[model samples]
Target: MRAPGAALEVALQAHPDDGFLLLRTARGAGGRPQDVEITWANPTALRLLGARVAPPCRASDAMPPDVVSQWVARYEKAVTGPGRSWTNGVHGSSGHDATGSLYSAAFFPADDGVVVHLRAASHVMSALARDALHDPLTDLPNRRLLDEYLGMALTRIARHRHPVGVLFCDVDNLKWVNDRLGHAAGDRLLRHVARRIRAAVRDEDFVARFGGDEFVVVVQDLPDLEAVSALAERVLAAVRGDLTLDAVSLHAGVSIGVAVATEAMTAAQVLSRADSALYRAKRQGRGRTRAFDTALSREVDRRLTLEADLRQAIERQELELAYQPLFDLSSDTLAGVEALIRWRHPSGTVRLPGSFLDVAEETGLIVPICEWVLATACTAARGWVPAAGPRFKLHLNHAACHLGDGQMTAHVQAALDSSGLDPGRVVVEVTESQVLTDFDEAHTALSALRALGVGVALDDFGTGYSSLTRLQRLPVDVVKLDGSFIEHLEHRDRDRDVVRSVIDLSHSLHAAVVGEGIETDDQQRVLRDLGCDLGQGFHLARPVGAAQVSAML
Candidate 1:
């Protein structure tokens, strides 16, 4: 005690902003630190607390009603149980907002009673709270806090076997909101929407702000899907009402997707169904609610299973390439072939890319599948390359996400370099919409690949936004007419006109055009007449293996 007293003088001299007090106590709680007693209060405590010498010595005696009265038990447990601890609470002080931190140094055996070394820890208390559970601007529960509360709610509901529904809420036009109005207005809109939703739901319902205008509402003890849909209707009504934010009067819309938990499903599965429902809502038009459908969910589950199978298909030697010839317009000769991926199942039946490619792209299994296709096509097309005549390109379709990634250049480069095939024989076909984002990066990657003598084609043109703009910007050598635009061209003159314009536009940009999905003789004749450089479809020929391409060559 004598040694610590001498050191206390040095400690007080070196430190500022910190309130200090000497505490002593007797052992209690079975071999625990002694129950605390306060001996002296340093000048820092008085200054920090803004408390005058009011005759009482214990810091708790000066605490405010909101501080001690509200949170005494939780805070007290931390204070007296452990050796040293701290917490945030308000103090009874003027000139300040009464926020401060309290730390009990030690609970030691004392002559009279226990003492907790407390000072106004308002700043620390506020900081702890700010970090604990909120999104700064909206003051909504963040992901971390959401998980904590959800865990608690789950525990309670599980014991009672009560139902809980999770709704995945996303603002329908946040990007539009940001672009049209401004980020400041966007922030205000988000906060405003958050407040409205909180007010719309029952007090017992849990609302958490998941990232970027997305909120997850957990409605506890719900009975059925209809009840959840009703809540979604209330949310929709609240969000879609005309409102003003930052002096900009506009209507905001939201699409809510609801997933109700069942004994048959996992939490992740439930959440995924909600996400899918959300997508369905977006498709049906925003500002609507879509409840999770079992049939629709089964499709999703099947797709997920297919996605998992596809990732290993290449390594398992289950994936193979099937090429369909694209004939030249004027020459009536085979100009090139578009390589399509096929899954050769154990049952000896063939699986088309349409059945699995979307899932592959979504699950990020497309990259490796594309790699296998590239390598296999190059290896198998070696014979077809020489006799397939000049300008016989092996067009390979790549996913949009793969094209957008800067890392794709390396994968492509590696595939081409390792395949020991001439780069001129292979062409990377990407959709026009894929390169729209970060065009500079796409340009850089495409240019690097082109420098290696690889060709680039913008597949699925004339369907997405600014097709002509993309044609001009991209370093594309060809444009494949999207099948959606080309499908009904046999009789639809409007479709025929759009296709003709796209072909002419492609030629104008010094890029050749290929009309895909030409499934009838009339479509073929019209495309040939229009000078569509290359044509691919079930009408001309079905997708065949590389050996078949060699035989055709």
Candidate 2:
């Protein structure tokens, strides 16, 4: 057998990357082993002992007292007797101990002493393991690790009968930032967002980036929905705070969807529930948190059904338009008809535009649906023979999808050519919100339509950011006052004053004003007395089919 000192010397010389140490048993006065003395150590071992200590040192002299105690406890089992072969896994503190970097040590009995091998635990891990478990950008946990953590949380809940909550956070308008500033700004925004979220959650909570401006948080052992909601609100507030990246003043908000697992649920189901709630928050306008419930689930299921049906709705002839007569208050007669789209469901029920228009817009179905409405309305207008007042006009609403596609003029011209309706008598109505969202695009589209001799009317005019400055910037031929303005017009002076000012502004712009949702003669009289030009509502005439419209004419 090699001598004790020779064994340690050969091991230290051969294994330069790992720390090597030879520890001899030191006994007390009663011949009982009291502790182990570090008889010899390699340069790597001295380095692992930290720069504060020298080579000839004991375990207690080299490491923290607690770590030395742990090391002694672990080595006691290995060094039972002389020539007894034993081994143990051990840990010790290293010089670069910011996060408490640890060395994994294995001790083996050799030639009346213990031979110890030490390596940094971090280096012992494979690169694939690190990459798979951590996000490369933010160094937070990735989706794979998230799945594991969420699954374990769910399992714990099942065993302990507690609730597991999750918050799915989505960055709103990230695409806008990416398009406006640059992708580099967008990436920095995401990293800052990740840090903010990490700072918001508890030390025990886990956060993961689930790709593309989406993050998932695993909240374990939440007691009830209130606790879950409170945590979600905290997370939202943390994410919604001001952020500036790379000398660019950027504003971004997060919409969070929350779900809790109190019963038997798979991780995917919980995530899907949260995702569905996120859809609701985004649909209701962003920067809010929504919790998953039975009603939302039902609504989601119904929307899914409607979306599938709407894809084939046009081919099935399930779509048609109704005309509501717009009256010219000055002429005291029917002025124009607004085409409204309705869906004839297979269940023998009629669905209003509100029931499915949002779904249509989201699914890109609004494009073809608007085209169809334009063609049908032009055809009906061409067939109409106005015997009394001026030539009848056909008013149709333009979807933002149409404006954003930059094809509004081509679609309008095609409809006119196919139906032979005069472009001078056709009015394409767009809402103020659409203009606000994509100002340049909507402006270009509307300007091009006006150049084609088609009049452009601003629908729902007073609801959004419709300042006089913005209104004057738009090249509109008419402005339809939103229904809210006329809802309380009989009582509220504020409503009346707003309508009066808008009327004056529109007239000054040489554009006519139309009051929508005029449900009473009193409201109509008030609007006309306020100098409103034209009006359309249930009081004027409810939306009617082609035959009813022809009869009314």
Candidate 3:
């Protein structure tokens, strides 16, 4: 009669899809299976084990360490039990499994010891699960897996009191490339970036694609903050280097925001801090690195709150125009007023434009806000005229963004027609810096205003890129010297010289020169000696509401 092993082997051969191996087990210390020997095996078992072996092969030699431990425990149970019955649901570990697989393992009683069987768990299902944790294009970890990795890293750091660093990377100008070169080119660029990042980092360091144009890296067991900074710089240099796509050379850069792991911080907290630093890096100018700090976080929060407040301020008509009187140096009398924007905040505090004007420009709210300023200034100018005496020129500061606006001319015309204020009484003042952004556009817009009988002044003249040649070419009627020159006119000879030269140049170009920020008697005398056409500052009169203008006049 055939032995039980032979009978089991014959039965296993009937199921070609499942693998079968007969193992001999020996008890060691603590009654555990210390050794496992392959006494017999079928062809299917040989393929599954990724091994070519005869009977009596050691289980440890054939499988991974983890798989061997599992097999030994099952072998002892099947061979030494009272019932000596077959048991199922044991699985092999990938530690020694060459197939890189999950298994449906079982053990059955045999003549010598026991028989082991394995059938690979659903291959398609396992692959699908893996795909979910990784990026399809770059094969790097996805955002979901990144969270898991970061959580585990944070836990390890907490226990060991070590540190982990997180680097948040954003690809700069990626949208421009995607729009100009096509999405296919953009995808290729991203794939190349992923490879470069992987090569630059250590083997154990984790990198992930945190969605479009963004990546996150986690460096474990950091020695110090300097090491974290060095890693960030290297990653930035690596991704920003030149690359080729479809035989065309291209370049891209990354802005990195760094956050070191803190003992009390959660995964979400760390991520948010890193994102705040990233925002700072982008704002300070791209292709830079910024570190997470309490101050930066607070500043970001304040800016966010201010942005919302400003949107409300515009809608609720909380914005008001403060008039700073301009004086004619020759007449020593009020010539006109500069309209300055002030925000009457909900907290009952008045805020200057420096606090929230940047937010307005970034959000495109400057368009509507500029329109309101023009209309309000024009309407207010009409109130002071004929009744108060002569028509005073109302000067309104203009940004380059206002000039390119399609509705700017119409807005100006409507303000003039509605207020019945002559265009000649309005002076649109633009800083030299603003005009340089699009000189041609500024020239065209200002020239159009001139045609409509409105005067254009080059504001903050000497502080910008405008030269005598360019200044002569611009269609302007006045040059407002920056406050710095007037402030230093008494102390610095260079400043006095610059002021005098500017006054002469403006006169030569048939444009009037206005000395700004005259706060002292000496500054006024110096500007007067320099023959400046107009002067405006707190020394003469601080910016006041419309009702206070009559008293100043």
Query: Candidate 3: what lDDT?
Result: 0.81
Q: Compare the candidates by lDDT and give the number of the best one.
A: 2
Model 3: per-residue Cα lDDT over 274-304, one tens digit each: 8888978987878989998778878878878
Model 1 stretches astray by more than 4 angstroms: 1-130, 135-137, 152-162, 171-196, 199-202, 211-213, 221-223, 233-255, 262-273, 279-288, 432-453, 465-474, 483-495
Global lDDT scores for all candidate models = 0.70, 0.82, 0.81
The prediction achieving the highest TM-score against the true structure is 2
lDDT of 2 at 58: 60
* Residue 88, model 3, lDDT: 42
- Candidate 2 local Cα displacement, residue 320, angstroms: 1.5
Cand. 1 TM to true fold: 0.68
Question: Model 1's lDDT to the true fold?
Answer: 0.70
Instruction: Record all residue pairs in model 3 with backbone atoms less than 3 Å apart, i.e. clashing.
Output: 64-96
- Backbone clash total for model 3 is 1
* RMSD from true fold, candidate 3: 15.2
Error of 1 at 271 (Å): 3.8
**Higher-ranked by TM-score: 1 or 3:** 1
